[model samples]
Target: MMLYPSIMKLMEKTGSRYSLVIATAKRAREIEAAAQETKNVDGARSISKAATEIADGTVVVFDADDADSADEVFED
Candidate 1:
């Protein structure tokens, strides 16, 4: 993924209060490693599980296949 200035801007705007969960099965380790390099974002492997309990309201940002899994997480 191309690094974008707007993403950093959004993170700065939100501050450390929000959790940033990256939902990727294969790249979980890499994602976590990269997230560690970032100063204040909390990273996790499971998007569905993490989304339900984010300190702030969750933002589910993922690729197409993972989007379908959100229904399972958010359904009543």
Candidate 2:
């Protein structure tokens, strides 16, 4: 049912579908963990939120060379 971000839009940010999936999943997990700690669940689901973040440029996929700093790409 999700449609705002659009797959093509997300793919444009991420070079490929595989990369997109990886980035989204990782962000979703982070979102879920944070929600658990704060006991808050009033926003979009983690998967959708992660996709939205990619579309909005709040998160990005880093190249292997930058793997060491990959965790820093996500911003609140």
Candidate 3:
């Protein structure tokens, strides 16, 4: 069958091309390194799993606002 979620759909979730690229690559590495613990089933390639997670919104991409808030939490 065709891919479950189109690239555009995944891109929309990420918001920007650079963010999409960064998120997908980081997720692919996570899947490859921890396939059993990850949402991806055994034998699935990392890239596919990454794409699927992005489409499903399982991976949250933190932007500048999120980072600023995070810093506030850690600051004295």
Using lDDT as the measure, the top candidate is 2
lDDT of 3 by residue, 1-76 (tens): 4376687898788788888889889998877778566655677677777888888978767676689875775585
Per-residue lDDT over 13-61 for candidate 2, one digit per residue giving the tens place of the 0 to 100 score: 9888989999999999999999999999986799999999999998877
By TM-score, rank the candidates, best first. Answer: 2, 3, 1
lDDT of candidate 1 over 46-70, digit per residue (tens): 3332333232334434445665786
Task: Estimate every model's Cα lDDT from 0 to 1.
Answer: 0.41, 0.88, 0.78
- Model 3 deviation from native, Cα RMSD in Å: 4.6
lDDT of 1: 0.41
lDDT of 2 at 39: 96
**In terms of TM-score, which candidate is strongest?**
2
Model 3 misplaced stretches (Cα beyond 4 Å)? 36-41, 69-76
RMSD of each predicted structure: 12.8, 3.8, 4.6
Clashing pairs in 2: none
TM-score attained by model 3:
0.69
Residue 30 lDDT in candidate 1? 46
Can you give the lDDT of residue 75 in candidate 3? 85
Q: Name the candidate, 2 or 3, with the larger lDDT value.
A: 2
